[model samples]
Target: MRSRRGVIEVNTAQIREVADGVPDVCIYELLYNENIEVIEDQCLSKRKCDSAILASDGTVGIFVKPDLPEEYRQFLLWHEYGHFKLHYDENMHFNFYLSRFSWKTEREANTFAALNLLKGEDIYDQNVIALLISKGVPERIAVKTYESLI
Candidate 1:
């Protein structure tokens, strides 16, 4: 993923390697090292909470709604990045926004984000739900991901 320069593309294998290799990955830094930019502007993606953008100029970015709570914003960024890494170069439009619905792509993106965010955490712990929630994952998503891991 980091092999490219001045271009927008997706390679999930490379992305997984990077994510897995890092202990305590910082999503922002993860995207930055991959040449993806993060933009916070509510107007850019009014139709959804966040969006993955592949610009005409070859710049790749995730656009997030600015007024969200910090924790939600964090997860939204990862969700958009999931869209970026997993769907962008496959068969997706140049601009894609996420809605709180259960479409296949949206579900896949959410699953992708959940897996990465919850990786290496002890899902068996009693505090797992609270832990993931405190870490910015929504309760429903946290519980779903936790159940899947179990």
Candidate 2:
């Protein structure tokens, strides 16, 4: 799909194929396999952001607050990986301050994370939806995940 920021195209099925059963472990594995560095820095707490910065050296640095819960952290990592997979290049530096681009990019990344993390779940089942909700996933994301699965 083309957006004002740029052309955004992602093969979500391919990403699902790469994500294993466990979301956290799967994201970590994906990052390592892609040679993206995972960095946990408390300094990110000051930035008020939980996003990844793509460095000029082909390293994607994930800035996560120290106090972030495990599940949320996993989601953040996957979201960052989504940016790396869909938008970033070796020469591209992602600046979150670009408001229009940031919104579009963030939506795509959230979709990517939700689809990959919720893959194989029976979204048609109410129990599954409840489980997702219980895990602190936003209802919109859970619904979007169902749409993606279909």
Question: What overall lDDT goes with each candidate model?
Answer: 0.62, 0.64
Residue pairs in collision within model 1: none
lDDT of 1 at 74: 73
Top TM-score model: 2
Q: Give lDDT tens digits, candidate 1, residues 1-150.
A: 212331233344444654465556778778788788888776855564454455445678777766778877777777777666555564334333333222544555555666677677776645777877887888987887556444
Residue ranges of candidate 2 with Cα displaced over 4 Å: 1-25, 91-96, 127-130, 134-150
Q: What is the Cα-based TM-score of model 1?
A: 0.66
lDDT of 2 by residue, 3-101 (tens): 555545445565555444435556778777767777778777678676555566544566667767777777788777777666666543446556555
For residue 36, give model 1's deviation from the true position in Å: 1.0
Candidate 1 residue spans exceeding 4 A from truth: 1-24, 44-52, 55-57, 90-102
Clashing pairs in 2: none
TM-score of each: 0.66, 0.70
